[model samples]
Target chain A: MNTFWIILTGALVAASCGFLGCFLILRRMAMLGDAISHSILPGIVIAFLLSGSRDILPMLIGAAVVGLLTVFIVQLLSQNGVKADAAIGVTFTALFSVGVVLVSLYTAQVDLDLDCVLYGEIAYVPWDTWQWGGIDMGPRAAWGIGGVFLLSLLLVGLFFKQFKLCSFDPALAAAIGIPVVFFHYLLMTLVSFTTVAAFESVGAILVVAMLVVPSATAYLLTEKLHVMLFISMGVGVLCSVFGYLLASWMDSSIAGSMTAVSGLLFLLAFLFSPRHGMVIRMLARRRMRLGTN
Target chain B: MNLLLALQDPNTQWVLMGCILLGTSSGILGCFAFLRGRSLVGDALAHAALPGVCMIFLLTGSKSIGLFLIGAGVAGLLASYSITAISRYSRIKEDTSLAIVLSVFFGIGIVLLTFIQHSASGNQSGLDKFLFGQAASLVKSDVVTIMIVASVLIGLTAILFKEFTLLSFDPGFGRGLGYPMGLLDGLLMLMLLMSVVIGLQAVGVVLVAAMLIAPAVTARYWTDKLSRMVVLSGVFGALSGVLGTLISTQQENLPTGPTIVLSATCFFVLSILFSPRRGVLARLFRFFKLRRKVLIEDVQQALYECLEEQAGSSRPGGVYLGIGSAELALKSGKSLSQVKSALAEMVRQKIVAERAKADGSSTWTFTPDGLKNSYLLVLNQRLWDLYHMNQNEYHHVHIDQSQEELAPQLTEEMLEKMLAQLEAYDLTPKLTEGTQAISRLYAREQGGLSL
Candidate 1:
């Protein structure tokens, strides 16, 4: 029963992150996604201070605001002649430093643990159950991450065509009167919400693994967008189950094990995927050489 | 007084010395990374060092800075290789590869770290400090290790400054020059990896990248030259280290790594907002100054065109007569207030004189020097346009508009040819007889002054 709740929480996180990761990698904004995850730490801490609890609402709003802010500032710096990578490095580190300072300063009053924030203990998820009207509702993380997963699925499904167009060619989208900037901020908002929701389950930094690795593997396997989305989410679920089992077996960090599993999956796809695998491509070239000879 | 007492403590001194050495090394090597547009490589390398540190501890059942450095160096090198390999062999973009390697390696590190914590000696190993460094824990031996590594880094950077510069700016050209560009690149990466590995003990894995990125970027805002940038970056980094260490020592719960990173960020913000050449304030100032110059030039050109039109209609008397501000505004297609302000500025410069009409409104006319200035301005405009039309090769060439004399820009033969071309097209600026009289008066005044 405990393993079920933990795996459920992990799957919800992987599903949401992997869904968004598809768009992020397609648009070449994967690092920006990583930056947003790290940079939102201050926002989460401030919200914790303001609410005096680990309530999800205030945390989500604060992190969403900061996440959009990260995107805005990165764009502003790059436009003003700062190199793109440096802009990302500067903005996120500065914000993350502030978060660390805040966390250390009020360590006593706040229940936020820096270690837990870095590498979350998903094992504890089954213990911290939420209650409603005197009845228990399993773990709070399952609900939170589940809500985010559904929100991403519904929104992404509704605007699938528009998002596809926007991701592939923003100029053509703009020419056809689609608000490119609007869709851009909308995507950023979803990414922020997903990141904050996944914070409890996968921690902050390792959530990037869930966000990028599965989608990147899916990207290698297919050229179709919908197929890529399905593959990524499927791989994300697989990582969750394997990661939970691996963590239990090794007695290690659950989020870390999940990400390590994703890494393994990506390695497999890199070498053996039928269409784009390096081994297959090499074989094809060698066969052509032999035939010509 | 409190600061004096704090600095007197040997513990504080060790921490300070260690931090300064760490900052200087990271800042110096960071310039090359920042210049090559590989700033995030530092972040990736920092995160990748964690599993290495954990692995060494697991294998040896003990911890040492030297062994950790070796472990971290190997891991960072492998991460870099994997990044390049993924991007090269697969269709994954470089950025996605960076994110992949960074997060996955960090995840693996976390796994190993947790496993270590569960071990018998895990609590005593003090490995969690590497996650968010505790610089207050530095001892004399740690400082010695940092000093030795820092000196080597500084010495190597100094010796290979020219080769590294070539590698950063143009590796292909360096290859053509018979330098082994590949070996040089690997050496620079090794230096970067060493700096990152050494810094992990003080600044931690999370914020060490900031030590590399912030000071170097701040230095970039202040200079265009690479040599000066490197020196300035090192100074900024060391200053931030001192500030971070001092402030952290004074407070109870303050951590040294974050405080240092924040100070470095403060320097970055200051440079972005206040640096002379590339700062936001300087760019804004130049933008407005250029706008004002363009405004004044447009008004002057419009007044000359109005005078030319009047001369073509009836007679040459309009040059001496003043035109109303409203009429001038209409001719210039500018607002009445804008035209009046421009005219007032011209009056202050003695380029134009204004007289109060019977209705108490101002009428403006150019003085002798003003007439000559406007004539040449109009003539240069027509001459350049005609030259551009005839000379397609020089279409994109920029002319120095600030020079008072055109002779420096165009040869005598070229000028005569351009004037002839302008005359053939009837595009030369026409001056009325009254304007010619004003020009002659200005010539005579100039001749008298020279005599």
Candidate 2:
């Protein structure tokens, strides 16, 4: 039962990030996802200090606000004449460091575990269960993460055309009266929501892996965005289950095990994908050299 | 304070010197990475070093920093090599390839790290510090190894600085010159790997790559020259190390890695917002000042055109027949309010005078100084326009900034050749390196090229 709950929590976090990851991958903003994950630290820290508890609402609101600020700062710097990557490197590190310093300053009294923010406490997920009038609702992380996953699904579904059009051609979308920047901020908000929600179970860096790795693996196997989205979600769910099993078998971190599984799956796809695998490319080159189609 | 004692302690001195050395070396190497659009490679390489550190500890059953660095270096190399190979062989774009390498390698590292933590190895007890880092654990021997690596990386950067500038600014040109592009790039990556791996003990694998990029990126806002940027980055890197080490010591439980990484970011934020030429604040000021000058000139031009439009038909100073804001706005192709505001400021400056009118609209005419200035602005604009029109080529990047400085005595024929030369040179900043010319053509990142 515990294992099932833990895997369910991981799966919900994975599902939210994986669905959003497809657009991030399409928009060439995977690094930006990494940046957002890093910058959310300061937000979560501030929210924890203010709320004086690990309440999910303050944490989500804080992470979302900071996530938007991260995008704003990056865009501000790039527009005012900094390179896009440098701007990202500058903002995320600074904010993340502030969070680290704050966590250290209040190390004694704060129930907030900073190390867990880095390494995650997914092993303890089953223990933090939600209940209603004595009725058990499994892990709270599962509910929080599941709620975010559903919101993302609804949001992505409703604005599917806008997100797709903007990701491919933002200028064209803007000309067609779509609010490109608003939609961009919306996507970033969702990214922040997903990242912070998962931060409890998977850690900040692991969020990057979940957002980027599965979608990227799916990218190797398919060219269509819709296909890639579903494939990545499938890959992500599988990673959570397998990763949970691997961690339990090895008596290690479930998040770490899950990330390792994600990597392993990507490697398999890289080396053996039927259409665009590395081995397939080598074979094609050989065949071409032999004067065959 | 404990910080004062920590500063006085000999062990603290060794750690401080070691961190400064690490910063200077990585700061120098990171300039190339930042310039060549590979800033995130440092982060990837940093994460990639983890599994190597864990594997080495498990294999050797000892906690040797050097052995771990070697393991980390090999792992980093494999990550970078695979990134390149993946992009080359697969249909994956470079960024997705980078994302793949980064996340996958880090995932494997996390797995290995968990395994070691769960294992019964005494040597691996403190290994988790490699993730967030605890610089206070540095020993005298660790400092010595760091110094050796630092000096070697610094010496290599100094010697190969020119080749690196070429490779970063223009790989095509480097290849055109018969340079071994792959070898040069590999050597650079290797240098970056050394710096990153060596610094792992202090800044940790999580934020070490950022320490590489932050100082270099900060330095970039201060200078366009690669050499100057490298030197500035090294200096900034060392300063951040000192600051971070000091801050951590002053506080009770502040870890050194994030502090050090954060210190570099402080320098970066300062550079991006406050640096003279490249900073956001400075550029915003320059842009507004230029636009205001252009705006005032537009009002003057509008008045002059209105005068000329009347001069040929109605006679002398008929242009000064008390022009209204609407007439000026029409002539300037600006809104009435925009023209009115310009007229207001000009009146305050005594460049124009306002007179009461019949229809309740105020009118303004140029003062003596205003007439002369307006004439000069008009003449300069037309000359620039004529040159651009005749040449059929202009960098819109320089159109506003280049007026009133064209050596007006030169003939049209001379101006044609000189304008092309000047336009290209203007696109590039005035730097001492020969590649500065080519970089101007290629590195237009500063002036919103390819924006």
Candidate 3:
């Protein structure tokens, strides 16, 4: 029962991140999510080092700050004539390295380590639960991730029209007096927050899987943004459930299990998705040829 | 200084040599990628190698770099193939496809790494670092492997350079020429994938992307000519590799991959600022020099005209021996004394002549040589204007033809006949005058010619 609840919580978290990630993926800012995931290491490290605790608020604030910084630095470098990809490479790697160095330097005195920051401890997560009024609330990760999901949902709901306009045609949006730069930053900031929040349960590395796979799978399945978001959220939840079960059965890491399941799902989608999948489309052609004959 | 002594060591020398070979070859292969405008595909492929590396380790229970690299190469190729397939078949953009492959593959890798760490296998501790890269662990055998792969990539690039260039610049033309565009494109992608895989051991996934793009971008600032750009990019890549390796060797824990990227970026920055002809500095310098020369020539021409105006009375001595000459020189930013000196020099040069002064000031007039020189300059300018007008007309015709919808039954022969007729009509003076007027109107604006 406990494990079921835990897995449910994981799926909910994954679904929320995936829902938000669809926009990022469609906008071709998937790598930006990856960059935010890696760059938040320093923020989390500093937060832990300063607070001497693994409280959700301080960690989220710290990671969000660093994540925002990553976006800003990448934008600044690109604005100053650095190519976008190169700027991303420079910003994320340097920040990640700095984070690693800080962790290594502080490990002697501080309780924090790079492993804890990178891979995270989803298994131990259930132990860190908070109580609400009269009920036994779930783990801190579930609540933290849930809060992020709500915030993202609110933002997305409020600016759904604006986001769609900007994502499809920023030039047109700018011409029509839409605040393109502000929206661009807002999207990036949301991505950063989602990444950090998801990092609590799934780890920094698997957060990329959550951000990319569901959206990519959705892309293969649909053309519309609304459809993509729904499909991505559905795929993420399924992967979370299947991955958790597989990890539990095989005594494997939940994060790895989730990623592998997602990868397998992508492969299936690539091979069987209607209109786009390779095998089905190829077979369809063969059938057409036979019919013509 | 002690680091200099370390360079004399055989181990250090070997590492340097290895980096040189790797860098040069990767740079050469990168030309195809740069020309294709898919320079960052190498980076995506590099990241894609991670999942493959992790999976191989999990399956084989071995940490052998050779096996690991082969796995990575396969994954890179798969990533490239997926990117191509996705972009071709779907409405998803190229960058999006790349990002999709990159994140999903790396995610799989991360998952695999976490699983491996949790597994009974005790050797999975440092597996995740392979995602970023650690070039210091390279051995002589690894260097040899890299060299072999690099050489193969370079040779393939060289062999297919002409075909690749054709396809890159104009795929339609390449197709018209009956070249196997698909085969050549695949070959180029294969070579690029191989280069990215090989670079993993030296720079790692995080920085290998820079290697593919930075050197090529740097070289672009140096030349418009393809051959020169390739060679220059190769040299820059090699220099960066050697320097990065050497720097990493000297400093403890300084990653080889990041160092190489930083060094490559330095080259890119320097080329942007200082490369000859096309560089920012050179362009700025040329602009200023041209402006100054134009100013100087305008002043001299104005002064010469004043002299000619005064000499119209046939009493050249009376015209030159007056205050008019001094006023012309003052208007042209020259002092009265300087104007006199200039007139004397011009007379010696046979561009102008000085006559006896009627009121203590000498008169001047333009010589036949000066008239001839001005006439030639005007003719040259006219010829240039005509050529550009004709070029613009040709471009407009080409664009119009491309945009026109024609029936499938309208064969190439028909198109050629139509073109011939158009050319014949274009030879008429009226048509020429029309084109000239359009070009003149276009030239009135201060913008580049739009394609």
Number of the top candidate by TM-score? 1
lDDT of 2 by residue, A178-226 (tens): 9999999999999999999999999988899899988988988998889
Off by over 4 Å in 2: A284-293, B1-4, B299-373, B379-451
Give the alpha carbon lDDT tens digit for every residue of B411-433 in model 3: 57644544454446442112111
**Candidate achieving the largest DockQ:** 1
lDDT of 1 by residue, B1-451 (tens): 9999999999888888878878888898999999988899999999999999999988886667888999999999999999999999999999999999999999999999998887657354668888877788777888888889998999999999999999999999999999999999889889999999988888889888988999999999999999999999999988898898888878777767788999999999999999999999999999999888878888988887876665456443332345778888998888988888899899888777776667887666666677778878878777766654666855555567566455458867777877887788876677632544334322232221000
Cα lDDT tens digits, model 1, A59-129, are 99999999999999999999999899999999998998899899999999878788888988898999988
Q: On lDDT, who's better, 1 or 2?
A: 1
Regions of candidate 1 where Cα sits further than 4 Å from its true position = A285-293, B120-125, B314-320, B384-408, B411-427, B432-451
Could you tell which candidate, 1 or 2, scores higher by TM-score? 1
Which residue pairs of candidate 2 clash? none
Sort the predicted structures by DockQ, highest score first: 1, 2, 3
lDDT over C-alpha atoms for residue B253 of model 3: 53
Clashes of each: 0, 0, 7
Q: What is the iRMSD of the candidate numbered 3?
A: 3.4
Residue-by-residue lDDT tens digits, candidate 3, A193-239: 77777776777756777887788888889888889899998998888
